[model samples]
Structure formats: C-alpha cells, structure tokens
Target chain A: MSEESDETLLKRLAAGEERAARFLLARYLPRVLALAQRMLGSRSEAEDVAQEVFLRIWKQAARWQPGGARFSTWVHRVTSNLCIDRLRVRKSAPLEDAALIADPAPGAESRVAEAEQSARVAAALQSLPERQRLALILVHYQELGNRETAEIMDCTVEAVEALLTRARKGLKDLLLKDAAFDAPVKAVSGERQ
Target chain B: MSAAGLDEQRLSELLAAYGADAARWPEEEAGALAGHPDLKSKIAKERALDEMLNAFKVEAPDAALSARILAARPGREMRHGTGVWRALMSALWPEGPVWVPMGTCAAALLFGLYIGASGALTAMSSDPQTETALLSLAMADSVLEENWDE
Candidate 1:
C-alpha cells in the first residue's frame, strides 16, 4: 500500500507475514540481482545468488532489529560476500582480471577516447586483489561510509582507506603509462557495471 | 589551502558522501562533505573509476530456476512447512521458563495416574486368593507390608 513504510513491512515480515515478504522481495530483488551480476560476472550465477539472498532474508527476517542498520546496506553486504565467494571459485580459465593494466590512455581525442580510458580503468579494477576490489567497490562506487565499508569488508576503517588509496593508485599507474593512446581498445563494456 | 587543510577523518567523510546522496549520510559527515573543496573531484574520480569496473547486470531467476530451487524431495516439503510454522511461532510468541515445569508436572501427573490404574486393573483381574491378600494388605498398609522391624 502507498502508506506502508519499509519498517512497517519489515515488522510484518519479521512476524512471518507472506504478503510483507512478497513486498520486500519485489522491492529489493532487482538491486540484489544487479549487484550479483556486477560482482560475479555471470547471469546464471547472479540468479542463483539472488534467490539465496531472498530466501535468507525470508528465513532470517525475525533476527532483524529495527533502527539497527539500513536494510539495503545489510542486503548489499550479503550479496557482495556471495559474489566474492563465487568469484574465488573460478580459478581455471585465463580470465581478464588484470587485462586493463594493458589498455591505452585517453589522449586529446573524442568521447570514444574517454570510453577507451574507462575501459582500461574497468579492466584495472577486476585485476585487483579481491579485498582491494571489494574495498574499492564499497567506498568508491557504492559510496558507503568508511566505517560501514570496513564493517562490510570485515576490516578496520583504516584498512578500507588504505585499500581505496592503493586501488586508485594502482589503477592510475596502470592507466597512465605510455601516454600514446593510439592502440585500438576493445568495443565491449566492462564485465561488471 | 594550507598543507594541513583537511584532517584524515574529514577527508574520509568527504569522500564517503561525495557521489552519494548527502541525506543518506550522518549530518556531521555530510557537513564535512559540503565543507571540503575536494569532494567534487574525488566523486568524479570514483565515478569514472566505477565505470571501468565491469557493470555486470545480474539476471533474475526465471520460473524454471525458481521451480528448481524450491523443489523438494520425498517428505522434505512437509518438513520445511513444519519448520516454517515453528519459526513463525517462535517469532510471534517466544517461549519462556514456564514450559519446563509445566511439562514436568504434566508428565508426573500422567505417570502417577498410569501406576494407580495399572495396580487397580491387576487387582481386579487377579486370582481370588491373591486379590483378597492384596485387599487385606492395602487395608493394613505399611506395618504388614514392610514387616515393621525398622
């Protein structure tokens, strides 16, 4: 209903109301799916992870405490953790984790040049160590507070800051080398958004 | 700006709120974000960098996927249904310490009734001599039954 606040729905959900659960699932599943797709790089895997995240929320809704944390934040943390676990298991192929380190820079050129630059940056991100990838995603992309990012990363705020700094610096060093931006960049978008 | 223009805490706060909605942030930290000169560039940097990070859009589960995940084997569905009921009950009305004593007393009362009923039925169905002896024993009580030495 138009008058239902998230907390009210969450309370109903905690009380095992199926209608509230359906509402919660409808409201948040897209975001969870988007996050899983971005982090895990596979639609099938993302779908699986999204289902698990929903079922988990449904099963454990009673454990939630109101006014404790943002529901989105909690769900985002769970989705991120699940994606990381899936990524860790894909060790067989010659994947493009660090392929952006080899991409060209954007010289005095067109929007295509900017796209190329972005492509390199994206490549550099996937290449980083998993912890650095997560820290960067939380702070730089998701814009989570340092403390929240640290909590999601299961580390200290100081560690998050350090990881951000390293991730950015690493990206810069890789993206800026050999300033001649004449190399033909790939037309594909990054693996994750 | 001086070299000591921004503290580390303020810098982190500025970076945290730069690209995101300021309203979602704590007021003190949001104030720091607004006050800091570098917030815009840091957010721009983050935005640009985020683009380079793959923007993978995950697909939602289709009916087939949902069907597979929700499928149960044998009597598993009934078990899960019961579990859901238990979860709902626990959430609605948490159990306290009273259940233990209530259960124990109920069990004891049930056991006492069982023993008394069994003894009576045995006495009723027994041989005449045995029944008379038992009846006399019951009437005379502990003195005859225990031999009274102690």
Candidate 2:
C-alpha cells in the first residue's frame, strides 16, 4: 500500500514484489542522484553511483535488519561510501575530473547569470576536500541531523560539527577569492535578515 | 543565565557551524540560545551564508537513469518461490550457519549403519539352512575318518 513504511516495502521487496522496487526507486532516486552528483561532480558518474547503490540495496534487502538504522539512512550511507570510493580512484587522474556545466543559452539574461552563479557554487563545492564537502552536503543539503551524518561518516557528532565549521569557512574563502559572489559577499556581514 | 545559558562566543560558533535556522542547530544549543538578545545580529550574518549554500540546487537525474538502474536489478524471477515448504523453511531458518541439517543427516547415517551391521550379525546366527549345512559338513568329515581307520 502507498501508506506502508519503508521497512514494510523492504519486506515486500525481499519477497520479490516488483511494485515494492518501484516504490523504493520512486521515493529515493532523486535524493540519491542529488547526493551522488554533489559528491562526484559528474552527472554520468553520479548515475553510475546511484545504480550501484540500488543494486546493493536489492542484494541486501533479504538480510536487512530493522533495528540498527533506518532504510533511508542506510541508503544514504551506501551512496556516500560509493561516491567516496569513486573519488578515491579519481584522485590519481584529478585533472580529468570536471563538474557538469549548465548551459542557459535559451533563457533570459538574468537566467544566464543564475546558471553561471550555480556553476560557480558547484565548482567551489567540488574544490573542497572530500570529507569536508561531504559534511556540508549531508548537513546543509541533505538536511540530516548531526548524529545521523556522524553515523554515515563513522565519526562522532563533535567531529561532524567541526567538519561543518571548516567546510563553511572553506566555501566562504573560495567564493570570496573568486569573483562569483563578490557584490553581495562584501555586504554579507552587515546585511540584516 | 550565564552558567547553563548560551554565551556569545559559543552562540557565534554554533551559528557559524550550523546555520541561521535554529531548528537545524543542535537541540541543546538551540534551547540555550533561544530568545537570547545577543544572538540576533549573529544569526542574521549566518542567514546570508545559509542562503548562499542553499542556492546550489542539484538537478534530478534523467528518466533514462532510472530505467538503467531498474534494468540492472537481478529481477523478481531470480527470487525463491513462495511455496509452503519454502515459506516454512524461510520462517524457520531464513539465513543460517547451515550446520543444523548437516548434523542431522550425519546422525541419521550413523544410526542406519549401526542397524544394518547388527541385523547382518543376527541373520548370520539365526538362519536354519546355514546351521544345517555346517552340521552336515562336520558329520561327513567324521564318517570319512572312520572308513580310513577300517
């Protein structure tokens, strides 16, 4: 049923129900894809990572234990680990790695500026160390709690907070040095909410 | 208010690390910082950072990506059948150490071997035809000996 929880859906999935797989895919695909994209900075690579994560989910569903972690958390853990592994392998060929660039050719002039700004943000994110970037993505974008992010990162909650602080500072430094947010960043400290 | 309350330094650090949104901040810190007059301007600065960070939106993957992931699955056909025997087995020992059935089979084999050996021994001692054949052979040998003596 549509109202069933992820654990119930997993039980059906383990029993080979096709609809359960569809349900899981529909619910988690966007989140996983977004995480993968943010982690890897490549659309094609993120897609591969998402596919691998789902494949692992299918294999592990039958043996999934409910008490340890929620299904969504487990899925994010898988996605994060796979993305990190891919990033590790890409370290040797760092020059080959490039973030996906968006083209806003057909849009209005303001839209083009927005697209360029988005690209700069993506580049700044990609420039961060893998762990720092991941910490930012988990807390800021994924909106997971500190404890949950710690569990995924295999660290304590304090460590996660420290990582986030450093990430925020690092992103600020990167954006300031570049000309991307120069106009508004100068006024950020004085700006009122 | 100073001992358990959020001081300016800690509140500033929390704002820098977590965001302008008090809800996203750690519960203990959020509670301590709530309605604290010193934190208003600090939170306003943090809000600018949060807005900048939130501006980077990730586009959803194409439909073809979903199709690819779906196609890579091992599929429903590869799963075990849901027959009564299978269901019962799954219920009993869904995943296992696998030694239970093996131990039972070994014990049954040993019992069968023991029964077979004891039955063979009993049959060898109890058969009338075999006993009669032995007695007849002994009598014929003694009769031959008496004829030789004569």
Best by TM-score: 2
Give the TM-score (vs. native) of candidate 2: 0.70
User: Candidate 2 DockQ category?
Assistant: incorrect
Q: For model 2, which pairs clash?
A: none
Q: For candidate 2, write residues A92-180 as lDDT tens digits.
A: 97444343442213267767666666766777787777888898898888988898999999999988988888777767765654433
lDDT of 1: 0.58
The local lDDT score (0 to 100) that residue A69 gets in candidate 2 is: 90
Model 2 per-residue lDDT at B115: 100
**Model 1 C-alpha lDDT per residue in residues B27-133, reported as the tens digit of each score:** 34554444556455555554443444433222344656544433311222332245666455435433222345458889999999999999888768889977767
Residue-level lDDT of model 2, residues B1-150, one tens digit each, is: 442576778887887788788777776666666667777766665676677767677777678887777667674323434567545544554332234655888999999999999988886887797666666676765754566689
- Residue A113 in model 1: lDDT: 56
DockQ of each: 0.05, 0.20
Worst ten in a row by lDDT for model 1 chain A: A184-193
